[model samples]
Target: MIEWFTIVQVSVAVAAGLLCVVLGLAGRKPSDLTMGAAALVEVLLIAQLVIAIASPAFGNEPTGSLLEFYIYLVSAVLLPVAGGFWALIERSRWSTVVLGAVCLAVAVMVYRMNVIWFVQGA
Candidate 1:
């Protein structure tokens, strides 16, 4: 995975999480801006996946674990895409909650990506 893209994804997820918390506190639904950010995050994740497929490296280790990589990649892409659509359809505080959940999940996915790249299973 691309380290820079991973960093960007993590930053975006944190920002989205903060936005969700603020929106939830204010009793406001998710705005288009929020959804847009989520979309941006998805785009970055796709880029990361492409980079990984092209150059799979984790701290000098060969990232040939296709199954693990694909699992994380698919989920990382799917969660935000689904959440963005679901938020648009729901358009309530629940939407923000969904976004928040997506953000949280993305964060976890990034961590998993790192582990997959940098650490060997015992």
Candidate 2:
């Protein structure tokens, strides 16, 4: 993984996590703005996956279990969507809580993924 890409992803994760937490704490119900932010983060994750996968073809392979990385990639991408769905169904401030939790989880997953990559790739 390129250094800059890793930084960008981590930054995104932090931003998304903080945003969700703030909204949740403010007792705001799920709003389009929150979902839209999640969607944007999801898009970045997808792009990251593509870059990570294709990098190997260009000879920048991560030494970690590509399988493990792929699994994290796929699962992390779904977290936001699942949270959003639950928020819509529950229709309460706690739904924002759920989204906040999801975002934080994704942040942790992103950091883990980066660790796995660097530990093995280095």
TM-score of each: 0.85, 0.89
Candidate 2 deviation (Cα RMSD): 1.8
Top-TM-score structure, candidate number: 2
Model 1: per-residue lDDT, tens digit, 1-122? 66666777788887886787677567888887778778877887888777777773434443446578678888888999899888888889878877877887887888778777766463
Q: Which 10 successive residues of model 2 have the least lDDT summed?
A: 113-122
Candidate 2 Cα errors over 4 Å, as ranges: none
The local distance difference test score of each candidate is 0.77, 0.79
The TM-score obtained by model 1 is: 0.85
Model 2, residue 2: what's the lDDT? 67
- Model 2 reaches what TM-score against the true structure? 0.89
Model 2 lDDT per residue over 22-109, tens place: 9888988889877777777788788878888788889877768878988888899899889888988997878887787787788788
Candidate number achieving the greatest lDDT relative to the actual structure: 2
